[model samples]
Target: MDMNEIREIFFQECEEQLAELETGLLKLNDGDRDPETVNAVFRAVHSIKGGAGAFALDDLVAFAHVFETTLDCVRSGKLEPSQDVLKVMLKSADVLADLTNAARDGGTVDESRSRALVKELEALANGEQPAAHAAPEPVAAKPAVAAAPAPTDSSGFQPIPFSFDDFGGEEEEVLMVAPTYSVTFKPRAELFSKGNEAALLLRDLSRIGEMSIHCHTGDVPTLDRMDPEGSYLSWTISIKTEKGEEGIRSVFEFAEWDCELDIKLAEEAEADDERPMIPVPFDLSLLEDEPVIGDEPHVEMHVEPVVAAAVAAAETATGVMQAAAAASARAEKKEAPAASAAAQANAANAANAAGQTIRVDLDRVDRLINLVGELVINQAMLSQSVIENDNNGTSSINMGLEELQQLTREIQDSVMAIRAQPVKPVFQRMARTVREIADITGKSVRLITEGENTEVDKTVIDKLAEPLTHMIRNAVDHGLEMPEKRIAAGKNPEGTVRLTAKHRSGRIVIELTDDGAGINREKVRQKAIDNDLITADANLSDEEIDNLIFHAGFSTADKVSDLSGRGVGMDVVKRSIQALGGRISIQSKPGQGSTFSMSLPLTLAVLDGMVVTVAGQTLVVPLTAIVETLQPEAAAIHSFGATQRLISIRNSFCPLVDVGRILNFRAQQANPVEGVALLVESEGGGQRALMVDAIQGQRQVVIKSLEANYMHVPGIAAATILGDGRVALILDVDAVVGASRGQSLRQEMSLAS
Candidate 1:
């Protein structure tokens, strides 16, 4: 394959292995120290090493080799997987990423950094004292090891060893031989002290045939400042050998990342030259044992395929047992297996055993969902058209159309459900963060997560990570306190950060609460006044003071700390949540703790909305924000001022806002006895009634973003296409009501108000 093809393969494999490594690391971090996870991590590194060797990418191969060695120690239990080990290993993974990116761009190896990293790896591999236990080793002076050979199994074909005396020879093979092959060599400036990696490649190639070396000094600068030991040169080699290109490529694999190299087969060869020979056919015998004779009738060897198939089939059967167990878990009694149910169970088991998770590109999933939403609109239009057609009121045709509409609705639901995934992964991520924060603060913190299985649209899940990270960090650094502080406050020394998620009234509600020092309202109020966020004499509620932390550039942490005292994380969380059509609220008690509750829409593409008509315009209010709708007599409305108003609902004066006027539409004077009042729940737990001309109906609307097509307009979340192909704005009820009052209700009730 050409260099470009090899590069593509390297990138693809690297990406897959990186993802596998990340997942395994996360599992390990979550306390899953299972042998499988360890083995998986090892396998990821091993595959990366193999791929690097094929591409003759020395930098990647070198890093993976060392990384694989360290993991091998862990796998063998010779080196304990201590937190320090994992931490260093994580850093090593980052270096591997750097090497990969650099190689992709055709850059020379970063020698200084590589040597430093290699020294660290050696220390880790040697099981030396961690940095905390002793001083770090100087990169140049650190002791070295000859390149370790790949471990031999029952079969031989041992990895070539590398040592410092043979680099010039290795450089010869890299340049003169293996010209048809592509070699990427990246050397640590200090690699010469440990191994003459280049010479080994030459020795390995001489075993096959004659080769030509072409050294290139393109990257070398003027000689004055150049360190002779540093690799200021790269090479392209041409070799004529019977050995396959891959065999020749492996010699420089370990140094691919640290040096620049290209190797390819020489074009012309002497027909009279003897063919290359191997002292021992290391892997040849293994291939010979399984030689293919014919498409069929090679039965002497192959019962294994049938047995493997049977084993897979049996695994699926076991999956059925698991599915049955799952179904029985939530049911009060055993459910009878109906025909369709049985088929579904079977299909599910087959799917499980097949273990083929359909990894759709996320873009494809989004497109599918969007198309389904359009289907829903078209379905609605069809239903509307049928109703309007009135074909002499034909009962059969009307009934058929209704059934078709129902089927279309079911299909839309099924498609949307495909995008829903349990929020367990995100919750688990936060749980890990909780542990990190606790360690940093030197405080006892136990994160208790509930409703991890609560499902949300994937789009919401993707955007949720940053906000959740900030919140968890805030809870750890600012919300919780040290053990001594907790003891003095009549709390458990091991403080608790409770993260709870659940579906509430068609929306997902996430609550992050901590049993530690709650928001210090007095301090917050004073800070707000000092910062001019409010006046000194302003009378604000405790809730409003708690929210000041969400204001940009506001932080209550008295001293800057590593986690979040610099005053730059929470406001972004608030804005992200709002951008997702969600609201965040905080509840706290002085000596107790604080709970931040965020209510988010279930899906970005669709929602159950209450349709209302006002001043010749139709608006859909997210049903989650609507408490109740009532056709109250207009006389019940009392004007507090020219614009301020209130309506008595359930013996309480709920604030009233005119939807038409709030949206800048022409307002009609209410017939003092008529008009509808829609009671809405504000984020602050306050109730408000929105006056509208009429309640049209309740239905699901596909939410289309207005901000995408136009700039963000307050009081409007998005616009939706109606059945008649007209556009109706989805009212952001919270923003509408808040903007009408010229301030957020939370701000209006601040302690400094």
Candidate 2:
């Protein structure tokens, strides 16, 4: 691949490292004192800095270097990860992400913001209290790379020489005598499970210099009693290499987190070196197959019995036998190399398959989804055609069609899952939002996120960010109380905003909650009146008052704040959700808290729907929208207002909406008693009974966007093709309810009256 492609991979890796950085820092903030967490956080920054330095991204490398240095202090336990320190590190992570994004996308970074963060990082590195809040003069821009830089390309990317200091020390000077060192490595189960092999690690180490490795197999149990997956083997090595200890450590860097490793000068670990160890020569085919450069080949000694015992012991303990029999055959150096070629080839292919991954273009995936959708529609059409034509007993064709339908559904589900990704990235972003908003509002706030790993389609996740961001901003700015206010209310000084996501009832639910002063019912009521959203004497319940925040043109704030109210208020949040085939609701307890729950479909491709007919026109209602369906009773119908009607169910009277009149499918409302009523939960947390002429069988249908092809209709969500090859509209239930309450159905009732 070319440098541009390599840079793209680098950027992709940067995202993973940034995620690790954020997760580790969050753990630190939660009072986790695990050393590995600190190391992971440091490694993430170091990796970014190293990559940045290679491209001579001076600004990025500089910021990441200082940030890494501050993290190093935490790793070494020279600095405590107090909430203050973690706060600065979290901000640094955000800046690092921004810098990386700018570099990858050719965008501009905020010099002022980065400069301020650099100051804080420097302060923390110097063992001083981090005054990162002060926007002091930015430190001078300097390349974090130490080695000489090569000539620059047209893209301004200059490759910097790789440095050995990252491992431990400089390797520029060669010693007269290679330094002898002792290494004791103990493998944990995680090492092998993570696709790391101790044999491979040993192979890399043996090439560094002249080395003798002794395998310890005393921990191994008998074959039947031993756990195949358990790690029961370890190795000790004595080496004299001019490359120094740094080179040795670099060999095992990938497995360091999964294994117990120790490296010291021979003099220091001489006592631990006294243990008896089996001479498991690194020259074995599996462990030391490759010939090391600069070393002369040794004459093979006829020590078959010793080699056999060692191979068996190692194989039994490690369980990493890529080619155990082939290795055994190769133990006799006189054996023909061709004897093991077939086995070796098969083993190599298996190894490659274990770690192979391919990155496909997202546009290609989208096209595949489109094709699968067409396949589903055509399959439905074919099945319908076959059933209608078959008067004879063609059970074979029927069985084939049944199998085909099942297979088609499987393919559709599998294709849609390819576009599914966890919502962690979006939730991680909310951390920064909470911090920035809290700073602006001058309130101490803590954000706790759970269920971030809940998966949803890429389309939903992409649009989800904007609305989720707005809600997070509002939760911190509006839902959370100030520090002093929380303290006075017998709560912790730090207000908390919690974000969670989960799959529920064939949809994804994202709930944002805050432990602070909730919606003030009286205040919200008066604000609704002032905004002309409701009548002055409107006997609104607390829930109704709470939901009025999402009413268009309504504002509880005297003036718009720079935080959540940057002018796309809760109303826009609600509209954006509705546009995504989703709905948002609110539940609040005065002086306690408020929760904003958004339920959205998993994918935009196929929807499970309840097919129905209204005014002789076919319509499909999203199954997720319908709570239950029932035949309305004549005794349960009651008139409301001058035009609207209500349906009484379970001692509760819910507004009954005529689906036909609301969509203008018919001029008059459908009789409630003669029609099927689908009880659906509306956007504002109220139930609406929708009257349809009849209930048809349920089926899975592909959603075809109307706005993309035709003009956007008010009460129509989208259109779909039916099994019999007819177009049917998908009813936007919430939109129809709104229309029924305000305009069309009431107008029809008035006209009929």
- Candidates' lDDT values, in order? 0.62, 0.70
Of candidate 2, the 10-residue stretch with the lowest lDDT total is: 292-301
- Alpha carbon deviation, residue 17, candidate 2 (Å): 0.9
Top model number, lDDT: 2
**Which residue segments of model 1 deviate by more than 4 Å?**
1-61, 77-368, 385-404, 421-455, 472-477, 480-501, 513-516, 557-567, 589-593, 623-692, 733-753
| Clash totals in order | 48, 0
Off by over 4 Å in 2: 128-354, 392-397, 521-541, 551-554, 559-561, 564-566, 625-658, 661-691, 710-715, 733-753
Query: lDDT tens string, model 1, 1-753?
Result: 233543454475576677567567656655788977887787677656544543446567677777776776676565677766776676566567668777777766667867787787778767643444221133223222111122332322222112211111111222233334333344555454443444444545644644434333345443233333344434344455556677766766665555655543334332322223212111221111222111100111101111211222222223322432343342335332222222223223322332344446789988988888888798777766876888676778788877876787787788779899878768766755776687788987777778988999999998898999999998888888899988887788988888899997778999999987888888888888878898988877665677788877788777877876677897888878877877788899877889999988878998778888888889998888888888776667677876577787767787777778766686454542466888887665567888888877877789987767775566677889877788999988767666565655444223211
What value does the lDDT take at residue 707 in candidate 2?
A: 63
lDDT of 2 at 574: 79
